[model samples]
Every structure is written in C-alpha cells, then in structure tokens.
Target: MVSRRAFLRGLFGSFLAALAMLIGLPLSYKWRKRMSPTRHSMPETRSGAIPLPYPRIRGEMSLEEAIAYRRSIRDYLDEPITLEELAQVLWAAQGVTETRYGFRAAPSAGATYPLEVYVVVAPRGVVLPSHDFLEPGSYRYVPQSHSLLIVRQGDLQEPLYRAALEQEWVLNAPVNIVIAAVYERTTRRYGERGIRYVHMEVGHVGQNIYLQATALGLATVAVGAFVDEEVQRIIGAGPHVHPLYIMPLAKPLEPYRVSKEELIGYIESHRKERR
Candidate 1:
C-alpha cells in the first residue's frame, strides 16, 4: 500500500501538470501567432509613383459632422473629381499615417494589412496641380508611397459598369475605389479566423472613405453586390487578391442639405426604380 504522503504528492504533481498544459499551450500558440508573417509578398518598394503629398493636411469637418452628412449618393453631377480630393479619400481609406510603424487610416488584425486599394478613373480629365496627369484607367494605390501605380492604360468605366451589374452610378462616377484582399497575408497569422478580420478591416476603411468624402463635399456609396471575378479582372488584380468592396465617388447633383420631404421623395423614387 502507498504511503499517504506519497499519494497526496502524486495528486499534486498531476494537478501541476494539468495546470501547466492549460497555461503553456496558449503561451506557445501566442508566441507563434506573434512571430508568424502577416505582410503580403508584394514588393516593399515599387518603381512607378504619383507622390500624393498634398493630402498630408487634415480636413475641416469634425467627425460628428461628417457622420451626419454621409449618404449613399447615386446621382452625380457631370464633373470630374480633382486629384486632391482623390488623394484625401485614398489617404482616409489606407494611406500611411504613421511612418514609424506603417500604421494606416484603417486598423488591421495583427497589423497585417491584407487589403489592396485600387482606383479606376473615368475617361474625363482629372486635373492635378492645374494640369491633367492620369489617363482614364485602373491604377493600384501604393500605400507605402502614397501614390498610384498605373495597372492598365485606357477607359475602364464600361467594363467596370458591366462587372457591377450595370450600376449607373458606377458608370457616372469619376472614380471607383476597389478594395481587394490577399487572404494568405492574414491567414498566415490567424489561420481561418483572419478572413473575418479582413472583412472587418474593410468596413473600417470604407467608413473612413465615406466620412472623408462627406467632409470634402463629395458623394460616394459603397458597392459590394458585384461579380467578384469580373471586378478583379477589370482592376487587373492578381489571382491572390480577392476584390471585397467597390466605392463609386462623385460630385452630387443634388444639394447635400435636403428637406425631409425631399429626402422622402428621393427614397420613393429609389423604391420605384428597384421595382
């Protein structure tokens, strides 16, 4: 028969082992999660550049005012959005704010910014610094450089409109900001859970753009209902980058300040169009 002291010691040892596992397993997992790669394999430094340094200045509108002014605008005036406005909106979406940590306007899980921003410009001229620079085409937003890298050269409005299920707003808008993600960038850090994180990050980025647009006196609407593959193709994104959100932006034809009756009338018209 075992001694009483030995039996109690054995039980204590077993309890310690179980407790160790409960603590050690999570600690080990956290270590791995902390060190695992979170960045995309894309080059850290690129060649082509636009250098949007003008957006360094902050906007005048308060966050509360922007939230109140934000709307899902579909009708737009026949006007081209200035390059400065584009820069501001892009900066709001994902532009690098903290150079030290490469922190952007939107937060990412584990700082693994998996989202890639792309801009599609209308055929009309976009004036920058008193002169037109960008031709009508799809351009990738290089967050690191805070500039656009031209992906393809030519008008892409028709293809984008087709891909977006013939959304007239897409066709009419001077710029369409496409948010795409490379899941592997996040998944490498959090496995399947990272996909959800990427989705959450997109929402944050989209809201930033909406608020920025409102503050700038521009109008925009986030478009998610689209043929995914078609949008990817239109934007010339690689196979790894999955398109997530499309935001069509433009100058609103109607005044931002509308009476309650006018808002109701607009809603009724929208309902009729949906039928």
Candidate 2:
C-alpha cells in the first residue's frame, strides 16, 4: 500500500495533467482551424461579373530578372495580349493574397486598400486560348472573388485615349489599366496623413504591375497626365473614386533591352552632355 502523503501527491499530478489536456485541446483545434488554407469555389457568373482564371504563383521569370528587364515601354505591337496574361497582370496589381485576413499582393496602410483597378480593353484586346476575345469594355476588378465586373458594354478606348491627353500609347495599346482610389477609405481611418499613404500604396501597385508585365514579356507605360474628371467619367467610376494612374499595356513592338553597363554608359554620356 502507498503512503497517504505519496498517494495525495500522485493524485495531484494526475489532476494537473487532466487540467492541461482540458485547456490545451480546444486551443490547439482553434489554431489548426485558423492556419488551414480555405478553399473558395468559383462563383457563378451573375450580375455581369466574370470570373478570371486563377493566377499562377510561379512564373518563368525570376523577380530579379523581372526587375532588371522592366522598362517604361511606350510602343507596342498591333496585337492583343492573352486573357491569362491580363489576369496575371491584374492579380499582381491588387489580387487577394491572404484569405484569412483579406490581405492583398501589395501592402496597404492599415489595410485600408483604397485603390480600385479597372481595365479598358480595346476590341479584341484580350484573347483566350480558343481565340475568343474578352468583350471590349471597362471592367472593375473585384479582389475578393477574383473576378471582373463589367462597368460598360462597349469600347471606351477613344474617350480614354482622349482623356489621357491623346497619348498615342493610350490609343494603340490593347489594354489600359486605370487605377483609382476612394480617399474616404484611408482618410477616414488615418486622417490627413492617409492621403500620403494612398499615394504610396499606388506607387507600390504600379511597381507590381511593371514587374509583372516585365515577367510576362509584355510592355507598359504609366500615364499620369490626364484630366481626372474625364478619365473618371470615361471609366464609369463614381465621383468618390478619383483616377490616379493609367497604365497602357501590350506586346512591345521592339523589346527595350539594356544591360547595366549600357545604362551606366548612357547616364555618363548624358552627364557629359550637360557638363
């Protein structure tokens, strides 16, 4: 028979182990549930919303390669980009990265995500593998569902081109990505400082688009000189959503490739000219 004191000590140890199990199991389950990736089924096409193809996580070009090759290409071939390429580019701009927290590809101030992305596709601008083209119109990117909501039913390229100060690239490029922002989203939370934050976020998004386009062997030029009201109206955006950047994207007519040494020499030559 065990001593009474020893028996009580063993009983206390058992009680402690039981208490730990009771507390730990529920916590572990909750953590596992949180950590697991949630799957979202493709939503039914309704309300003029078209689901975009799932974006690929991996690409042929490395991040470094993409950065090195990135150029502000203005001239493009008279050809259309594929639907998949358009999807990838849009995903890079503002696609949701984390489902649990509703995080996006680019960082945002307090996760305000004030920016909205719209694509103005020219007639036969984006082609599918089957040679079918995405209907030419302005479509709003909805990140949560990874889909495009049709804003307008016909080509707004001429109006958009005119609004973008009649830039040839704007008229020629097969697709124009219009980045707009609703100030209230960020401003309401961060006060006046949020305006700066929104600008910073747009820059981040622009860089993402540039790099992604580079990776896809495409070309784009960010056009900032535009009548804000005109672009807003052309893209069918509400008054609250102000236009920020218009990036015209397409296949470059001639790829602008330059090595580091070539760039350095060019800079030096420019400096000499100034001197």
Candidate 3:
C-alpha cells in the first residue's frame, strides 16, 4: 500500500512543518514577553507609568498660613523640584481623596468630575531623592492611581512657552501644570448649566494648587492668556478635552512678603490717586 513515491512525499511534508515551527516559536515568545505587563516595574524601566509617592495630609504649614502667604509669583530660579513636592501638588489638584465613592480633592458638580490635569516637565525639572531626574515630557495625572501616564516624550518647554503667548515664566519654570476639561462628563447630567459648574470646579482646583504650593514654599502663577488650540495640542489632549489653565511652578527668585496692613495701605494710596 505504501509506494516509495508516497513515503518520500510524506517525509518531505513532515520536515517542512518542523522547519516552520523552529522559525516561528522564538518570534512568538519574544512578542509575548514584550507585550506582557510588569506590575512592579520601576520608573527607570520606562514602563510609561510612574507611581507617585503618598501625599502627606498634614503638612507643616497650617491652612491659614498657606492662604496668607499665597501670592502670584512670576520670576523663578533655575532649579529642579522634588518628586514628592510634585506629588503633593498633583494630589491637591485632583487626587482621589475618598476611595469608596471616588471623591476627588476638588469638589465636582454632582460628583461628575470633568477636569483632567497634565504636567509638562522641563529638562532636569523633577528630581528623585537619589538625584535621578524624570525625563522631560508631558504626563497626564491619573487621580485614581495617583500616578502619571507619559503622554509625550522630550522637552516641550519652548513649544509650551510659545503656546502660552511667549511668557518667560512658562519657559523659566521647572514644571507647568495644565488643567483641561471634558465638558461631556458634567454636561450630560446637567445640560448647559453644567458648563458653569465645570468652570467653578476648575477655580476650586486652582485655589487648591495655589495653597498647596505656598505651603510647600514653592511659587506658582495662574496663567490664563494663551492660544487654547496650541495648548491642547502640546498636552496631547483629545478633541473633547479643552485646556482652561496653565500654572508655571518653581522656587521664587526672591520671596515676596506683605502684610494685610501693607496691602490695605497700597490700595488706599491708589484709591486716593484715582479720586
């Protein structure tokens, strides 16, 4: 029943199948290994997600002190801010304060949070305790995980500065925090009125950032003048996400200190001149 031609043909088919497996198996293994997620991967591994240190609830500065010292600072020294400081500021902006209900630090209208926070880091902008620096890039803050997801790699300071109407502070500061809104998150529930709520929520978040920065002896100024479309592109935001604010943060070149009385006196002087 087995002819010599038939046996030769069967042997040839088996050899080809073996050769194919030898070629394909290694490639398949390599792909799977590359695609697999390592949950405990370190930042140096470039896994694209960086876990932030836990935020401290009790800072040295009291709430009143932070409020009193809060001022819009424009000039900054060339220096890198610590990752811990960055973490606290991000937490203040929108980190989840309650796990069970997923409530954020900033109050959302009807618990429908529409705000997204992003940070654009300059070269040598943020440093770890070991003195290693975070790669200069745009990172989107994930509130639930208290982590940063890399959006784009490489220095974006110049582009962001140009986008912000060539503000020197944007270029000079070590980091810039950009706040964007996804209106649908709120608008779906409250309709057009939700737009107003979203604005209010952003204001709250901005104030939180200001206070937190002040408490940490950091300086920041809320920058509103910029081309919206350019900023959205620089942050790699989706079409639905619209930028609302850009805050440049760094150590002040000189600390500005003023008492309430001094502020009142200056105001009075200006009022007298106007009259």
Candidate 4:
C-alpha cells in the first residue's frame, strides 16, 4: 500500500493532469496560419552566438515617469527594434545586476531564480531597416553572460501567435519574450509554498519590463491567455518548465493619448453595459 503522503501527491497530480486535458485539448491551435498576412518564413539559426551590449544602467526617463507612462499597447509600427532596445528590455526583465551577490533586477525568492527568459526574434519579411544583425529564431537569455543562447532558429512568431490565441500583436511584434518557470527550483526549499513565491517573482519581472518599455518608448503587453503545453513547445521548453507569461515588444504605431472625461465616460458606459 502507498503511504498517505504518496497517495495525496498522486491524487493531486491526477487532478492537475485531468484539469490540463480538459482545458488544454480544446484550446489547441485551430488557427494555424489561417489569418491574413501570412507569417514570415522560419529564420535560420546562427552557428555562433551573438553577444548583447552591456545594458545601459542609466535612462533619461525617471522611474516615476516610466510608471505613469506605462500602458498596454497592442498596435505596433512596421519598424524593427534594434538589438540594443531588445537587450535593454531583456536586461530589465531578469539581467544580473549585483554581480558579486549574483542577484537579478527582479527579486527571486531565495535567489532560486526559477524564471527563464526566451526571446523570439523575427526580422525577415518585415518592411523596415534590416535587423539581420541577429538571427531570426528563438533564443534563451543567458543572464550571466549577458548574451542570447540560440535554442532554435527560425521564424517562431507564427507558432507563438497561434499558441497565444492568435493575437495579432504576438505575430506583429518584432520580438516576443516568453517567461517560463521551473517550480522545482523554488519548491525544494519551501515545499508547496514555493509555488506562490514563483508567481510573485513573475509579477515583479513583468512590471520591470513594462516600465523599461515605457522608458524606451517601446510597447509591450503581458499575455496570459495561452495553452501552457503549446507555449512550452513553441519556446522549446521542457515539460517540467511552466510557461507563465508572454510579452511581445515593438515600436508603437501612434502616440498614446487619453482624456480624463473620456475615460470616465467609458467606465460609466461599461457599467451601464454590465447592468
């Protein structure tokens, strides 16, 4: 007979498996390239790794300004994001800051650093200054080296967009950053409580990227609606790694504007509609 601890663990695992099957199967990619403006062809991986510039620690925009300017922007321009902009955003997300202590920009519980950052770069077929300096493919951000490790090269935006419920922004953005978490990193120390810590860490990472995007005048939105397994597959993440967030980065199509009265009116209108 199995011990009580083993029995509960098995039961919980079965519950999670059943929940995933119930939700994951129906939400599988049904819109694979079924929309307008076909995705760019797959990008070839570079044989050698490309080093990223040292992230600029100083910014013209103050932290308060960045926080105030932050917003969820979906529409993007056709221009490509330079490698420097990409590096800045990635660095803000999880780059090493305190080298001696091995700490990151975001605070990780016990410095377990469960989050893994993956960048999906697609520079081909885009009608902009060729950002061909870097290969078009999926790359994992190596925080220690401050460089990208090419996991898989090719235009992965198509599959990533599909996995993201066919969101246009996911496809249109020049780069998409996928964040995955390995719970075992945290759980070993805190047991079940470690799961909660991992999620909190992700939130910190997301806000950091959002603020950094604002400072750079770039656009990004946190995307949570996705099939976990599909996202894991798209980013070439293993089954043990859980995909937690997707942030597509690009230059905005137009300026951000809003009126106080217009906002209040919209909120009232939404209330009326709900009623």
Candidate 5:
C-alpha cells in the first residue's frame, strides 16, 4: 500500500527523469562529441611543478600493431617513458575527437558526462623509467587535450598502496589513472535506473584505457580494490565524483597474452541480446 503523497512523489520523480533524459541526453551527446571552441587550456594550479604539454601523435600504430603490443608490466625497464608516449596514451584514453561534439576516448551515458580521470604521476617532477626514481605525487587529467594536472605532490605511495589494499602494483606503476564516477550526471535523467547506465559507461572508459595502453606497447591492469573515499580525497573530486575503478599502466615486454576463445565467448554472449 502506498500513500497518496509517496505515490505522487514517485510519479514526479519519474516524470522529471524522463523529461531530463529527453533534453539532456542529446545535449550530453553533443557535449561529448564536440570539441572545445578554445584551444587546450590546462586548469590553473600553483603546484610549482609545471606539467609538460606533449604534442599528441594520433594514428601512429595500426590496431593490430597495438594489440600485438598489449601487456601488463609490473616491472618496467631501466628507462623512463618519453613525453610523446605519455601524451599518446592519454589521448587514446580520452582525447577529443574533432573539436566538436566532445566525443572523448570513452563513451558516456546520454552524453551526460560522469567520469573524471586523474593520474598519480610518480615523482613530483617527471618519473623516469630509468634508475633515477622520480618523486611520487597525484595529478588530475585535463581531458580537453589529455594534459597532466598536479594535485597532491609528495610520497603518497605508502598511503596510496595501503588504500589499494596493499597492492604492491600501486607503488610500482609509473602512472595510475583513477577513474571517478559522478552518479548524478546520469541519475538526474534516468533516476535510480541511471545507476546501471553509469556503471556501463565507466566500463567503457576503462576498456578504452586498456586498449590504448595495449596499443602503445604499455602494460595496464584494471584495479577496483582501493578505498573509494580515500581515492576521491586524493584526487580531489567532490562528493559527486565517486571513485569506481583504478587502472595502473607501465611498459611491458614483447608478446601480449590473448585468449581467442574467451574473446569469442564474450562476443557471442552479447550478439543476440545484451540481456
């Protein structure tokens, strides 16, 4: 039995969700698909260390070439990564497509963007893959052009590693992307039902990162073990930007691991109907 007031509230919530979706979905899609009218602007922050803006090189490798390079390296070589490689990886993860319709590296729910990317760049300055270790610090990703924005600069590895349930990989990876989810972006439209859509969108972004890393001859693995609040606090997202997944990436050895049978199984499951 439902009270009149509760019934009306439910009806109102549904109506509001439908109306918002009707209008917001297209706008969100256009927003994701379009590029910023202005050139890339790194968000202003006085963090002392200036984040280097690397020119992103696109279409450098064929899909097969990238697939061949896919791997997850816990141990990197004795050499640091080049700026160009970093830029390329970030761009592939979420770079703007055509300066219109903000089509980013990953898909979204109704174009109502809900994900924010951040980097935990090792070393306060540039992290060298070589012997001279760089300092440990946290950074936010500027998606407009995939630039790194320094957030908390210090030896956060211990805390971060602990937050991630003592996963040694957290301390070892050269760079980690903390993928945060802002639920309301979609919930405002689809209401509670939007929860499912938001989760799907996050997976899309994570896969985008994996594929891009694989393409760039880098190693990466998806992580979801860290304390959500701790990650959010470190990355400096509001209550809305809830952390969902963390992906740490590094350079790997040649020859990626692939399971053709597993891939086929996945393709078949969704071929008829996702349900």
Candidate 6:
C-alpha cells in the first residue's frame, strides 16, 4: 500500500491529466497570420539567447504598503540602470515563483496562461539574459526559466512609436514592456464570453508590474494606443495573439501624489458590485 501522502499525490496528478485530456487543445493558433494595421510587429524568432541576468530581489511588501505606493508615472531621467534592476523588474512582473506547479507571477484564466511578456531594452542601463544585444530589438521573455528568446533584431523604436500612434511615452522610456494575449486561450474554455477573463488577467499582471515598479523606485506608464496589427508585427507575434497594453519603464521624474478624496472615490468605484 502507498503512504497517504503518495496516494494523494497520485490522485491529484491523475486528476489533472484527465482534466487536460478532456479539455482537448482549446486554442491552437488557427489565426496564425491574422495581422492588423497599427499593431506591434516583430520577426518570427530569435537566432540567439536574450540577455537575462540574475534578478535583484527585495523582501516582500505588505499589502497596504504595496497599495499605498502604487501609481502611474510617465517622466523619467535619462539614466543608466543595472542588469540586476532589469531582472528584478521582469521577475516581479511575471517570473515563476515555484516551478513545481507552473504557477506564474501573474494569474491566468484556467491556467491556460495566454499572456506573453516582451522587452525593449537600452544598452546603457542593463545587460540582458545572454548578454546578446541584437541591437535595439524586441525579444520574447521566458518567465518560467527567466530567459529571453530573440524575436526581432535592429532598432524597432520607430515602428513601435508609430504603432503606439506616436505616443511619446513609448519613446521616452528606457524600456518598454509589452503584454499580449491569445484571446482564445481563455475563450475556448468558457466560450467567447470568457474573453472577460483574458482582460481580467491582463489587468492583474498590469497591477503586479505597477506594484513592483513602486517598490523598486521606478517609473512606468501603461498605454493602450496602438494599431493592433502593427504591434503584433513589431513583436513578431503569431496571428492568434494580440497586443493589449504597453508599459514603458524608466526612472522616476517625480514622486507620486494623490488626494484622500480621489483615493476614496477610486476605491468606492472599484468596490461597487457589477450590475
């Protein structure tokens, strides 16, 4: 007879296997080349490794502290940052904490996990995963193992700037973190109505990054202005996945401030139950 712990472990493993099989492959790139104008564009794949250094880490913050501190910032200093700082930012945004369960720094719909993280880094501030500088390009971020896969090489600032509809914030920052999602990743499970889950997951990840930036003493601005097709192209994304938000990261220009009334109103609005 197996020990109780072993028996439970077996049961759980079997259950997950059965669940996966029953679900089938919910969403598998049917819209492979569906591009939209103005979306982020990128090359197909990277020929080399991306520079991802060991992340710099800090102790966890209390929920209150994280909330009280979180805010959106746009202005930054034209300063150089460390490879360690970049690592810490990515880890805080979506790095895997525990490999056993394949859990991520962000939540997903049904753990289908459709969100992809990418980065546009400058040379002065940080050295990346493999110390590979493909020269001003976008890269795919592998969070589970903390590595980057090159997608596109060469300066993409102009295209990204255009795709973002000439959002100066995208060009002003030292790095840009783009988050995209395969909508069907969640929708296929619960049907098209589940698209809400995809957006919800995006928001969760967005907030996670925001909190991390706050704690790290950095500035970040989330932008939603872009032609979806161009963005997908800038990142060299496949057809099914599409851009959702762009977060430009940099040093802070000034401290964040908010009035008590504004804070109260924000909380109250969020707290109200959906009709």
Task: Please give, for residues 1-275, the per-residue lDDT of candidate 6 as tens digits.
Answer: 34566445544644674474334322211122232223223222232344466665554665566677677787778864555666677887778775555567887655666688887765443433444322456766777557665566556766888899998767777678899987765675568767888888889888888878777777787888899999899887878878999888888888575567888998888889543
Using all chains and alpha carbons, the TM-scores for the candidates as numbered come to 0.76, 0.79, 0.80, 0.75, 0.67, 0.71
Best by lDDT: 3
Clashes of each: 0, 0, 0, 3, 23, 29
Model 2 C-alpha lDDT per residue in residues 1-275, reported as the tens digit of each score: 43566445434644664485456546543553354354212243633357888999999988977888898999899999987899999999999898755578999876767899999999889987667777777878878778886666577899999999899999999999999998887787679999999999999999999999999999998889999999999888889999999999999988767688987898999999998
The worst-scoring run of ten residues by lDDT in candidate 1 lies at 39-48
Task: After superposing candidate 3 on the true structure, give the runs of residues whose Cα lies further than 4 Å from its correct spot.
Answer: 1-47, 260-275
lDDT of 3 by residue, 1-275 (tens): 33556445434644663484456546543543464443223352233457898899999988877888899999999999999999999999999898655678998876777898999999899997668787687888878678886666678999999999999999999999999998987787679999999999999999999999999999999999999999999987878999999999899888666678987899999999998
Tens digits of per-residue lDDT for model 4 on 27-123?
3222222321444232322323346767999999888678767898999998788778888889999998986545789998767678999998886
Per-residue alpha-carbon lDDT of model 5 for 28-83, expressed as tens digits? 33542253343222332332223445545566666765664555556554344554
- Model 6 scores worst on lDDT over the 10 consecutive residues at 27-36
Error of 5 at 70 (Å): 3.4
Model 6 vs. true fold: TM: 0.71
Tell me the whole-model lDDT of each prediction, alpha carbons only: 0.78, 0.83, 0.84, 0.78, 0.63, 0.68
Estimate the overall C-alpha local distance difference test score of candidate 2.
0.83
Lowest lDDT sum, 10 consecutive residues, model 2, at: 39-48
* Model 1 stretches astray by more than 4 angstroms: 1-46, 258-275
Candidate 6 lDDT for residue 163: 91
Candidate 4: regions farther than 4 A off: 1-48, 125-131, 257-275
In model 2, where do residues sit more than 4 Å from their true spots? 1-44, 260-275
C-alpha lDDT of candidate 3 relative to the true structure = 0.84
Number of clashing residue pairs, candidate 3 = 0
Candidate 6: which stretches are off by over 4 Å? 1-47, 55-57, 60-63, 123-134, 257-275
